[model samples]
Every structure is written in C-alpha cells, then in structure tokens.
Target: MLKDNYGRRFYYLRLSVTDICNFRCNYCLPDGYQCGESIAREKPLSVAEVNTVVRAFASLGTEKVRFTGGEPSLRKDLVQLIETAVNVDGIRRVAITTNGYRLASQIDAWQRAGLDQLNVSVDSLDPQRFRAITGHDKLANVLRGIDRALELGVSTKVNSVLLREHNLAGFEQFLDWVKVTPVSLRFIELMRTGDNRDFFASNHVAGRDIEKWLLHTGWELLPRGRDAGPAKEYTHPDYIGRIGLIMPYSRDFCAGCNRLRMSAQGALHLCLFAEAGIDLRSAIASGDHRDLAALIRSAVCGKSAGHQLDRGFTGATRNLAMLGG
Candidate 1:
C-alpha cells in the first residue's frame, strides 16, 4: 500500500478533465474572465489517455477516483471517461464534483455510465446572491437539477463553500434543503486561492462555526467515524441525511491525508496546494506502461503530509481552476 508522510493510505485520486467552465465563480477563477479564450493551449486528455493514467495509479493501490473540472460534465465524452476508470482493475468507487447546472439533463447518462456519487457546488439558494457569486443567474436551474438527481435515485451531495460576508448566513437553509432529500450536505472552508485574497480576505469559515450552527438547529453532530476527506460529518436528530464540514484552513487533517490529484492536461498533483506537478502525460505518450507505473509510485511517495494552507504555509500560488480543486 502506498502511504504519504502522514502514514495514511493514499488511495483517492481527483482528476480534472477540462479547465474551461461556463460560470465564473468568484472563488474558482479570475473575475469576469472569458472562459474559452483564457483556457490553456494544451488540449484535454483523451479517454484512452485518462484510462492509462488511471491504470498506472490503480496498479500502485489507488482505489477511488473523483472526476472534477472547471466543470467535468462540460466534457462531451465525460461518460466514456467515467466508464473507462470504473472498469480499471482496482478502482472501487467513482464520483464527480460539478457545478450542478448541467445535471438535470445529464444525471441519467451519468448514472448509466457507473458513476457512484456526486458532489454538486451550490453556493447560495437566493437567485440574486447566486448570480453575484457564480456570475450567472442559474440558481433555479441548479436547484431543479438537484431535485432531478435525487428523484432519479443518484447518491447526491451539495457542496457549499462557506464564504464569510457572502453566504455563510444562509448555511442553515442549505442544510434544510439536504434534510428533505437523500443528498449529503458538505460545508467547506474557503481557502486562499487564485484572486480570492484580493476580493475577500475574511471569508474563511471554520468547522467549529458549522458545528455551532448545527447545535442551534437542534441537531447532534456524530463523531468522526472514518478516514475520508477533511470533512467532519454530523447527523441531525430524526433526519434522514447528514452534514459534513471540510476545514482545510482552520483545522488541518494533514496527519490523516490520503488523496492525490491529476490536472486536466495530465500532471499528477500530490497535494492540492502544490505549486508544481509531475507529468504523467509525457510518459503515457511514450507508450511505456511500466515507466508510467513507476512514475505514479514516485509521485505518491512525494505526496506531502497535508497542504501548507493549514500551517499558514502559503507558498503555492496556482489558481484553483488550474489545480482542479
């Protein structure tokens, strides 16, 4: 089994298939930037190329894969890529992190392709606020998409990044939305990435604040059960679903770290806050599976205990869009 400096088994891989997205979320990219024009020159990896990279990591004991992008569902061949990864020998679970706007139409196709779960990014329920945050007024579309996914029996989760002045006050309403459906709600702390430092400095919300908010709602947060991501989960009294909190900045889970990432163009990231990455595309293009597998092992070994964002270690300067966070 491959392990990082934390001694936790590093088996999760978050792969980005594209860097271009339809919406310009304030936290994810530069404000008002043109999507297609600002994208990098390199084309996204083909399904076969992504499959090769998945095989290399699976050979070294990687077990779970999460497809992400500026918006992964935006990829025309997303289902093919998901199917390819699922068929890999050691891959046990497959998931995707999306903006939730395209899900109403694509959920059925995605489920048919063997997708295991989903994490939809929904910043605010209010239409005007949502427009301000995402630079689009598609809040109604996203909500309908969520309802459609829940109705179709797909395991869904709502991902709400807690930004201080923006929508932190509406967190309880988000939790209430999750309580009615089978979807799990995850409140993530805002990390310093891209131009986030310039727009909002005090927007970083911690896990403790979430826990306290849950208390006022007469819910009891269950204790930590497994070594999943940084999110600490809680259960509401008599409620069917649960809530999760990811405090990457306030409370670091560095010692229990167990994940790695792959950029859209095919660089493997050992840590989300990493400034540099190892090129897996070059080895794959050479058509040497053995060399590619060796490179993956080396990359895992180089995985940091946790990102420096937690330690006030802010050396990484890459935008979250490029990093596929």
Candidate 2:
C-alpha cells in the first residue's frame, strides 16, 4: 500500500475522467463551464489511458477506484471506464460520482457495466430551490434516478452543499426525506477555493453546527470506513437513512486521509487543495505501467500531513469543478 510521511496509508483512488461539467451551480460554477475556449482543443484521457492509470494504482494496493468528474456522466465512455476499473485485479470497488443527468436513463446499463456504487449531487429537495441553486429544473428527474438506483439495490448517496442563508434552512426538509429513504444524505461544507473566496465568506456554513444538531437530536455517530471519504456519518434509530458531513475545515480533517486524486489531464493531486500537481500523463500515455507505478509511489511518499486551509491558502484549485466534485 502507498504510505505517506505522516503514517497515512492510501487505499482509495479518485480519478477524474473529464473536467467538463454542465451545471452552473451557484457555489462552484455560476456561469456554466467557462474554459471551453482554452480547452477546446484539449482531449480528455482516452479509455486505454484511464485503464493504465487504474491498473498502476491497483498494483500499488489501491482497493477502491472512484470515477469522478466535472460531471462524470458527461463523458461518453464513462461506463466503459467503470468496467475497466472493475476488471482491475486489486480494485475491490468501482464507483462513480456524477450529477445524475443520465442516471435515470442509463443507470441500468451502468449496473450491467459492473458499477459497485453511485454518488449523485442533489443539492435541494424542492424542485424550484434546486433549480435556483443548480441552474437546472430537473430535480424531479434526478429523484427518479435515485429511486431507480435504490430499486435496483444499488448503494446510492445524495450530496448537498450546505450554503448559508440559501439551502441551509432546508435541513429539516432533507431530514424528512431521508427519514424513510435508505440512501445516505451527505451535506458538504462550502469550502473556500481559489475563485470562491468572496462567496465562501458570504455563505460558508460551518459543518460543526449540523454535527452538534445531529448529536443533540439523538443521532448516533457512526464509525468511519477504512477507505471512505472525509465524511463524519451519523444515524438515527427512527430514520432509515443516514447523514454525513464532509467538513474540510474541521479539526484534524486530513489526519485520516487515505485517498489520492488524479485530474482528467493526468496530474496527481496530493490533496484537493494542493499546489497544482505532479504530471504523470506522459508515463501513463507511454503505456509503461512499471514507470507509472513507480511515480505514484514516489508521489505518495512526499504527501503532507494536512492542507493549509486554516491559513487562507487555496492552492492551485481555482474551482472545484476544475477537478470535479
């Protein structure tokens, strides 16, 4: 397994298939995709290249591989990518995090393609509120997609970004919906990225508030999975579903970091908030698996203990969409 200098061992891999999202989310990308002109001639990693990357990680004992993106569903060969990861020898779980645009329509096909889990971004319960937040009026359809995933017995999760004075007031509504649904309802704290500094100041809601509320309301804090993302999950006896908080600013947030990320263009991101990255595109494209594996090991060895978010340095991450949610 890949171990960092801080005694943290990596077992999960989050790979971006593309950085081209269609959502103009108020928090992340309010004006839709803005770098189309700059990247118009740039092509995302091909299917074979993605396979090479996944195989290299697997060789290094990476057990979980998650396909993320500006919107992973936007990529035409996303299902193929999932299938490829599923076939990797050491990869135990193959998942995808998407916006659920084609979920309701293509979920069955995806299930057949060997997808083990799914995480969809559904920022709001109310269709109108959802529309206002995401700039899309398809909450109903997205809900349908969630329903289909549930009906198919797929492990489904819903992620919402808690924005101050915007959808924070709808926590109760989220509670009501999750009371019976079996999916995991996660609220990600609005983080201060390179470009969202002003917006973060105006709307950044501390996740601790919600964590306190959950404990006060008889919710039981659950233990974190070995290879799970940074979400402190909670469950209630009465509720069928569970709640989770992905609070980047929380104390000791990065102490348990066990995952590594790679951009669509093949740059290794030590942390989401790390300065740019170490490029492995050439090695990955060269089809030299041994060289790529060596590079991954060397990169993880130099991993820092934590991010410097408390000091107000956002690093090379101008926007979350540039990497993927």
Candidate 3:
C-alpha cells in the first residue's frame, strides 16, 4: 500500500479527464477572459493509458477513484473510462465531479457504467449570480440536472465554493435549497488559486462559522464524521443529507489526508498547491506501467506533513484549470 509520511494509506486517486471546459468561471480565469485558444498541444493521456495507470494503482491497494476535469462531462468517452476503472482489481468506488450542465443527459448512462457518487459544482441558488460566477447563464439546466440525479437516487453532493462577496449572502439560501431537495450541501472555502485573488480576496471562513450560522437557524448541526477529500462533515439533525465544510485555509486536515491527485495531462501532484509534479506520462507511454505506479507510490510516500500555505497561502496564478477546484 502507498503510505504517506503521516502514516495514512493513499487509497483515493483523482484523475482529471480533460482540460477543456464549456464554462469559464471567473474564479477559474482572469479578469476579461477569452477562451478560444486550445491547449490540445499539451497532449492528454489516452483513456486506455489512463486505465492502465489506474490498474497499477489498484494493484497498489487503491480502493476509490474520482474523475474530474476542467469539466469532466465535456469528455465524450467518460462512460467508457468509468466502466474501465470500475473493473480495476481493487477499485470499489468510482466517482465523478462535474459542473452539472450535462448531468441530466448523462445520468442514466453514467449510473449504468458503475458511477458510485457524483459531486456537482453549484455555487448559488440565484440564477443571475450563478451566471456571474460561472460565466454561464444556464442555471435552469444545472437545476434540472440536480433534480434528475436525486430522482434516480444517485448519491449526489452539491459542491458550493464560498467566496467572500460572491455567494456569501446565499449561504442560508443554499441550505434551504438542499432542504427542498435530496442532495447534500457542501461549503467549500475558496482557495487562493488561479486569478481568484484578482476577483476577490482570500476569505478564510472557518467551519465553525458555518456551524454557528446553522445553529442560529435552530437546525441542530451534529458532526457526522469525515467524508473524503478534506471535507469535515456534519448533518442537520432534521435534514435528510449532510452539510460539509472543506476548510483548507482556516483548518488543515493534512494529518488525515489520504488522497493523491493526477493532473489532466498525467503529472502526479503530491499536494494541491505543489510547485512541481512528478511526470508519469512518459513512463506510461513507454509501456512501463509498473514504473509509473512506483512514481505514484513514491510521490505519496513524500507527501508533506502538511502545507505551510494555510497561514498565508497565495497560489500561483498559472495553475492549470483541472488541477484545483
């Protein structure tokens, strides 16, 4: 098994399927953004190539896998990739994180392909605000997608990135939105990544702030234990699903971190804000799957006890879209 310095076994792997996305969210792009240029020259690993690496990870005791992207739904062959990973030796859970614009159409096919869970990036309940944040006015489409996933009984989670002025006012509104629906709501503290600092300051809202807010609503919040990917979870006693907080800034869960991330093009990132990555593309393409797997194991073995960025973390503006949330 791949073990980190903190003695946590690295069992979960997040693989980004592609770097292309339909929506250009402000947090993901710079001010006055333009999106015509293609990074196709960067060369993303083929689906089979990805699956081969996954099989190696499975051999090393990985039990869960997550598919992500600039928007994973943008990948047409996503279902095939999902099916392949699910059949890997030790993979028991397979999930996808998408922007939810296309979930309504792909839900049935994806469920049949063995997708175990879904995390949709949805920030605001207000249509206009969502349009401003994501640069897409298709709020109706995403809303329908959430409804469809719930109707099919998929284990769905709605990921809301809480920025200072952006969607802060809608925090309670989001809670109410989940109250009316079956999807669990997660409050993701917006990390200082991309050109995010340009649009807004890094607002470090503690998980207790969320807990305090929920307490005022008289909806008793109880710790429901930790979920995957650094999100400490809680559930309203009267609510059906849970409320989660991903406080990478205010609180670091590096001690309990049990995951590794693979970039869209094939770099193995030991930490989310790492300055460099271990190259696995060349090893995989050389038909040395074991070497590529060893690289992953070694990367995990070197995972820093924790990142120093929590105190004064300011991200480099050039991180690829697929790397961070």
Ranking of all predicted structures according to lDDT, beginning with the best and ending with the worst: 2, 1, 3
Candidate 3: which pairs clash? none
The CA lDDT at 171 in model 3 is 77
Give the alpha carbon lDDT tens digit for every residue of 1-325 in model 3.
8887678777888888876777767667633334444443467767788888788788788888998877888788898999999988889889998888898889889989999789988888899889888888888888888788778777899888777777888877877676667777888876665455555465545566876776686655454322366676666666677777777755546777777878777888787776666778877777666887787777776677776665545433253365645
**What's each prediction's TM-score?**
0.91, 0.98, 0.90
Better of 2 and 3 by lDDT: 2
What TM value does model 3 have?
A: 0.90
Error of 3 at 276 (Å): 0.9
Alpha-carbon deviation at 2 in model 3, angstroms: 0.8
Question: Residue 70's C-alpha lDDT in candidate 1?
Answer: 78
Instruction: List, in order, the clash count of every candidate structure.
Output: 0, 0, 0
Model 1 — TM-score against the truth? 0.91
Best by lDDT: 2
Model 2, CA-based lDDT: 0.88
Q: Candidate 1: which pairs clash?
A: none
lDDT for each residue of candidate 2 in 1-325, tens digit (9 for 90 to 100):
7888888988899998888888989888888887754455457789999889999998888899988888999888877988889998988898889888789998998899988789999888988899999899999889999999998888988899998867988889999999999989999989889788889999998899989989999999899888888888999999999999999998999999989999998999999988878988899999877789999999888788888898898889888887875
lDDT of each: 0.77, 0.88, 0.75
